[model samples]
Structure formats: C-alpha cells, structure tokens
Target: MRISLDGQVALVTGAGRGLGRAIALALAGAGAEVVSVARTPADLNSLREEGGALIRPMVADVLDASFYAQVEALERLDILVNNAGGNKPMPMVDVDDETLDRLLALNIRSVYKTAQAAARRMVAQGSGVIVNMSSQMGRVGSPRRTVYCLSKHAVEGLTKAMAVELAPNGVRVVSVAPTFVLTPMTEPMFANPDFSAFVMDRIPMKKLASVEDVANAVVFLASPAAGLITGESLAIDGGWTAQ
Candidate 1:
C-alpha cells in the first residue's frame, strides 16, 4: 500500500546523521515537511542542502530548554521521531555513575521531555504520532549493555504509558526498536572479528539492519498506514530478538 504524509509536519531529533538523518530524509520523501534537529551546524547545513526546502534544520541540543522553546514555537506538529540517543558498551561491573546518568539523560529524559512538548501540540490539534526510537536491547539483555538496555527498557515503558494516556486525545505513541544497524557510527564497532562474529551469529538473517530499514519503519508508523498501531514496538532486528 502506498503511504503519503503530504501536508504533515514532522520533527526528527538527531537528524544530522546516521539513522536519524535517514529517517528525516525518508519522512520528507514521503511528502512531509521535516524539521531536522541536531547539535552540529555543519551537519544540519549538509542535511538542508541534500533534503532541499522540505527540510528545516534546527541546530540545538535536544536536552536544552531552548530546544523545547523552538518546538513550542512550531505552528503544528503531526509527527515526532525521538531519535536522539546513544549507547556506551561496557561490562556491568564497569558501569559508572556518570555514564549511567549521561545515558539516562539522553535516552530517557530527553525523550520524555521532547515527547511531552510535542504531545501538547498534538493533543490540542487532536491528532499526532510520536515514534520513540528504541533498541532490540530494550527487549533482551546483552553482556556489556546494562545501561543501554536500562534506558531503552524505560523508553518501552514510557511509550506504552504515553499511548494509554494520550489515546483519548487522538495522539498515538509507539516505538521503533532496531537491531544493530549498519551505519558509520556502528561500522567501527564491528571491526573486532570476535564482536562481528558474535553479532552475526545472533541474527538469524546473518546481516545487520540498514538505516533505510529502520527509516522505512518510522515513516510507515508515522503515516496513516499504521493508524491502529500504538503502544507497541516494531522491531527491525533481522530476527535477532526472535531467536
């Protein structure tokens, strides 16, 4: 089925690069006007050039109060992709307080605040879609991803709770949980043969998901095609979590 988001406005956090960049482009390609947020001016400028007029580049940290002010200034927000987050792989015993706080701030706190800001506009308009970026790690544990898993699992719970509370207001909340996707940021991690082999063995499809894979899911979920899909996670994990 063909999905179109013409006339809709989408805001994608972390859109300057990697999966978020792919998602922002995909949304614009699907006919939505996209506001791309990121910390680097150069990256946002690059995206603006590539994405053309449909892309509005916003250089701001998602965790900043100024970011929320910018979001509040938008006339309308039809879709919100909470894609700004990171992972620090370290043994559970090696997890430090600072690392844990940082991950939680970015992965959970920022997501919640961003979604809350968008939800207000959406609720007033009486329709909107919020797609929280999650990870397969959210559903299953890994040896060196204790903090990453914790933050994502919290995102999973947040998605559901937000969905339940906002459904009556015509706002939808969902999550896109992807497996280790092949991106510039992640390609280096696979340089280790042991790590690469371990990951390859776990994925039944024997390959990492591409940025396009995750982007496609986000676009579909934000479109009318996924109208009834809320409070749920679409795993683009190449059968890894299915194992």
Candidate 2:
C-alpha cells in the first residue's frame, strides 16, 4: 500500500543534496508540500526544478538562531526532518576543541533548537511527526568517529526525551540511523578501496545504503502509517549493528 501525505506540510533541513535532497523529493512525491531548506540556493534551485510546485526552496543555515524563527513561522508544519549535520573523522586524541565545538553546534544544538520550535507548533495543533537524521554510527562505535558518534548518541537521547514528553501532546519524535549511505559527502571515503572494503566487511549485507533507502525510511516515519512508532531510532543499517 502507498503512504499518502496529501495536504501536509514538511520542512526538511539540508535539502540541497544527498540524503536530505532525497527526503525532500520523497515527501513531495508523497503529496506533501515540502519546504526544502539549505544554505546553497543552487541546490534548492535544482530541487525546485525537479520537484516543481510541490517543493518550496528556502535558503538558510540551520545553525543560525534566527532559523528557528523561520521554522516557527510556518503556519502549518505537519512534519519536521532535521537532516542537517556534518562530520569529520579523527582519532580521539587528535580531536581538537574546534572540531568538538563545531560538531556539537551543528548536530546537537541545531537539532534541539529546531525540534523545540517545531514541537511547539505541533503541540499547539495537537499532532505532528519529527524524523531526525542520525547515523548507524549512532548505534554502534568505530575508530576515528568518536565525535560523530557522540553527537548522534545525544540525538538519540534527545529523541527519547522529547518523545516521552510530547506523546501526550500528539507529537512523535523519532530518528533514522542509516549506515554509510552513498552520497556526495561519502563518495571520497568509498573511493579508497581499502576503506570501502572495510565498510563492506562490517555490514552483513556487504553493501552500503542508498539515498533512497534512507529516504524511504524517513517518509515512513513522517507518515501516518507509523503513528505508533516513537521514542526510537529506526536503524536502516543493513545488519551492521546486529553483529
């Protein structure tokens, strides 16, 4: 059966490219009016060209405090996809103050701020869904990923906290944790044969996730079909965490 989000409004962060762009397109395909937000206008322009009238491109950095005002300004936000975040792999000892600060600001602080703004509106309306873009690294650990893992762990914790608090108000908070999705950001890693093999070896499926794979999960979590799923991190990890 097909999921329908007809008449709903969705706000997707980092919608310029990669997984975020895919999620924005998926939402539009499901009939939601999608507000695609990203710092780059060109990416949003491409999204608009592809998604047509169903997609509204908005240029903004999710890290900006004023961005919450834009989110709060949405008169009717049915769904919020916090997909904006960045990562740089470094050994635990090599991780500097600046790197840690940047990761926390982008991954944890921005997500928390955006969620609060969206949750407030959802509480007022008495219903909404929030899907955060986490990572399989959030569930498990890896070398040189301490910072990324930490941020995602915080995301999971915050998701649970918000889920419990907002359930009474008809808002559901959840996260999607996918393994090594093949995106522009990750192509460089996959370009190295040894690193690519290492990633493949970790997954029982021996394959990386696709943009559509994660996007499908996001669409489901954002839809009414997943009405009862909350306070959980849905892993699209290709069995990597099972081991």
Candidate 3:
C-alpha cells in the first residue's frame, strides 16, 4: 500500500542534514509541505536547493525561544519531527557539567518545548502526529554515552506521557529510535576502528541503519498507516538493542 501525506504540513528540526534532511525530503516526496529547521543558513539553503519548492528552509536553533514562537505562528502543523539533538561521547567520569547541560538542553528540553508548541496547535485542530528522534542508546546503556542515553531515555518517557495526555485531543506522540546511522555527524566517530568495531559487533545485522531507514519509519509513523500506533518507539536499530 502507498502512504501519502498530501495536504499535510510537516515541521522537521535539524533538517539541514543527515536523517532530518532525509525525512524532510521524504515527507515532501509523499506530498507534504515541509518546513525544515536548522541553525545553519548555509545548510538550510543547500537543503532547500536539493528538496525544491516543497521544502521551506527555516534558519533557527531549536533551543531558542524564537523557535517556539515561530512554531506557534505556523498556519497549521500536522506533523512534527523533533530531530535536533547532539551527543558528546565521554566516559562517565569525564562527563562534565557543561556537557551534561548542553545535551539536556538540546536533547530533552528543546524536544519537550517544540512538541508542546506543536501539540497546542494540533489539539486545537484535533489532529496531529509527533515523531521524536531517539536512539538505540535510549533503549539500552552504553559505556561512554551516559548523558546522551539519559536524555534519550527521558524522551522515551516523554513520548509515552504525551501520547496518553494528547490521545483524547486526537494528537499522537511517538518516537523513532535508530541505531548508529552513518552521517556527516557520525562518520568521524565510526572512523575510529575501535568504535566501529564496538558498534558493528553489537548489531546483530552487523551493519548500521541508513538515513532512509530512519526517515521511512518517521514518515510511516506520521502517516495514517500508523493510525493505531502511539506512545511507542519504532526501532530501526538493525537489532542492536535486542542484545
């Protein structure tokens, strides 16, 4: 069966690159008008050039107050992809307060706030879908990603809570938890043979998930095909968390 988002409006955070970019393009390809958000003007411009007229590039940081205001001002929001986040891998002992604060602000706080703004609009209209970008790290622990894992775990919990609270309003909340997908951000991390080995060894499939893998899941979750799915995380992990 074909999934279509025709006549829908979607907002994707961090859409200038990686999985976010792929998701925005996919949603547009499915006939949705996509507003792509990112802090880098260059990246957003490039994205717009690549994704064409259906993609509206918005240069804004998800952590900024203005971002929420902008979201509130949207004519209508049918889908929200909370995909802007960061991670600094370090051992638990080396994780400093700055790193913890940064990760928390970017990962959980911004996600919650963005969803709140979009949900308000969706609730008023009595329909919408929220796709929070989580990670396999959210589902399971890792050696040097304590804070990253913490923030994502919070996201998982937030998804369930929001789904329950918003269901009555006809707004669905869910998360897409992907294994390490090779992207500009992760290419350097995987460049390390040891790190690559560590990741590959954990995945039963012995390969990383692709950007399309994660994007397809987000689109499906946002589409009517997943009407009954909410408060759950769809893992595109290549079975990494299964172990």
- Model 2 over residues 1-243: C-alpha lDDT tens digits? 789999999999999999999999999999999999999998899899999899999999988889999898889999999999999998999999999999999999999999999998899999999998898888889999999999999999999999999999999999999999998789989889999989999999888899999998999999989999999999998999988
Per-residue CA lDDT of model 1 for 47-163, tens digit only, reads 989888999998899989889878877899999999999989999999899999999999999999999999989998999999999999999999999999999999999999999
**lDDT per model, in order?**
0.94, 0.94, 0.93
Clash totals in order: 0, 0, 0
Worst 10 residues of 1 by lDDT: 65-74
TM-score (all chains, Cα) for each model: 0.98, 0.98, 0.98
Taking every candidate in turn, the Cα RMSD to the unseen true structure, in Å, is 0.8, 0.7, 0.8
In model 2, which range of ten residues has the least summed lDDT?
132-141
Candidate ordering by lDDT (highest first): 1, 2, 3
Model 2 clash pairs are: none
